[model samples]
Target: MDKTYLEINKQSWDEAAHRFFGRNPLPDYGPLAPSEDELNLFGDVTNLNVLEIGCGSGHSLRYMDQRNAGELWGLDLSKKQIEAAKTVLKNCHSPVHLFESPMEDNPGLPTNHFDIIFSIYALGWTTNLDKTFANVNQYLKKGGIFIFSWEHPIYNRVSNENSTLLFNKSYHEEGSYYHEAWSEPAVMQQYKISTYINTLINNGFKIERMIEDVRLTKEDIQRDSNRWYSYEKAKALPTSVIIKSQKL
Candidate 1:
């Protein structure tokens, strides 16, 4: 039987979680990469009901909780990632409802329950943007905010190894792209920026803010010379994009 994309991703992430947890301690927000804090995307989440789509060990969930967010919930496709999240939450005396499910499949979460639905570097893994956005719209309360971040479409246009910032792939190509450098091969969808905006608008979301985070400093490059995608390359292009929208 052929494996589904979700199944392949689950296997890869599960293995990654196992290996990652073995070597590292529970992660905080910034060290994973540059954070959304600089943008202040979800301002003052205090007492707001928030859901994270691809919560991955619940670091971001915990971060929100610490910021005094109310009724925190998280969803991830990988069981190992959920397990790691549970462990971290338990140690911190934080209670969070974590669900193991794909974002596109409607994971039995209550409709009109969340004031905010967000993800960081996760939604790109979703194969069906329309279904995913529609599902998110259902779970979010009317006028609730939906914020997410993903690898910039432009970043994928260049060869992963090239620091010269040359276009290796057309920006219009939307399909599965494989990462060969990881210990476990990983696959992610490449979509034009318009696809995300159009899908959200079609699903009843109004765009509030959109940011392309390409803030690379000289210190950042000098500090991480051994990095595979160096700061020089990142400085020349947008590395990630963050979108903040509201359900209309």
Candidate 2:
């Protein structure tokens, strides 16, 4: 029998996890998205409980620690990633808790607990968004904030050729796909933008802000245009989406 996508992803990360250490971390949300310094999303995090979903290598957890957050907690499906996070956060000033488990599972985290929960380019890995959102809703306090950033849904459906952007895939089609651009095959979900917002609303979250702006710097633009995700392509359209929601 074929292995599950979850299993495949985990296995792939188990081997290649070190390559992504501290990649696309906080202070900045994700690739080309605005910095928290500009957006100030989680202002004054001092002594506040924080949890991270898909916290790879504990880079964001380290950011939370630097902010003097009360409790630093994270969960990831890859065991090796969790180990790397443990090493990264072993000397944190605040309490650090790491769990190796799928975001789809309950993992027995305290309900209505976290003051702020965020995922950086991580939520897209979930096979079941409804279950994941339901779990996130269950874990957050009323009025607590949830911030996450991921590759824009439309970014998946478009490609650039000779400085021209072309829509090659159906934006309406939503499901799992094998993104072979990585060294390993990445089995991830592709959902319409509405699905994300509606799912959050359905799970009792009030959308605070939905930012689709491209915030690439001059240095980012100076990168080679022939690269997989060219700065020119990113400038043409939003490559990342950052959504801030509050549990209600």
Residue 61 of model 1: what lDDT? 79
Q: List the residue pairs that clash in candidate 2.
A: none
TM-score of each: 0.87, 0.95
Clashes of each: 0, 0
Q: What is the C-alpha RMSD of each candidate to the true structure, in Å?
A: 3.3, 2.0
Candidate 1 structure lDDT: 0.76
Winner by TM-score: 2
Candidate 1: clashing pairs of residues: none
Candidate 1 per-residue C-alpha lDDT over 166-201 given as tens digits, one digit per residue, 9 for 90 to 100:
778788888787866577778788899999999999
TM-score of 2: 0.95
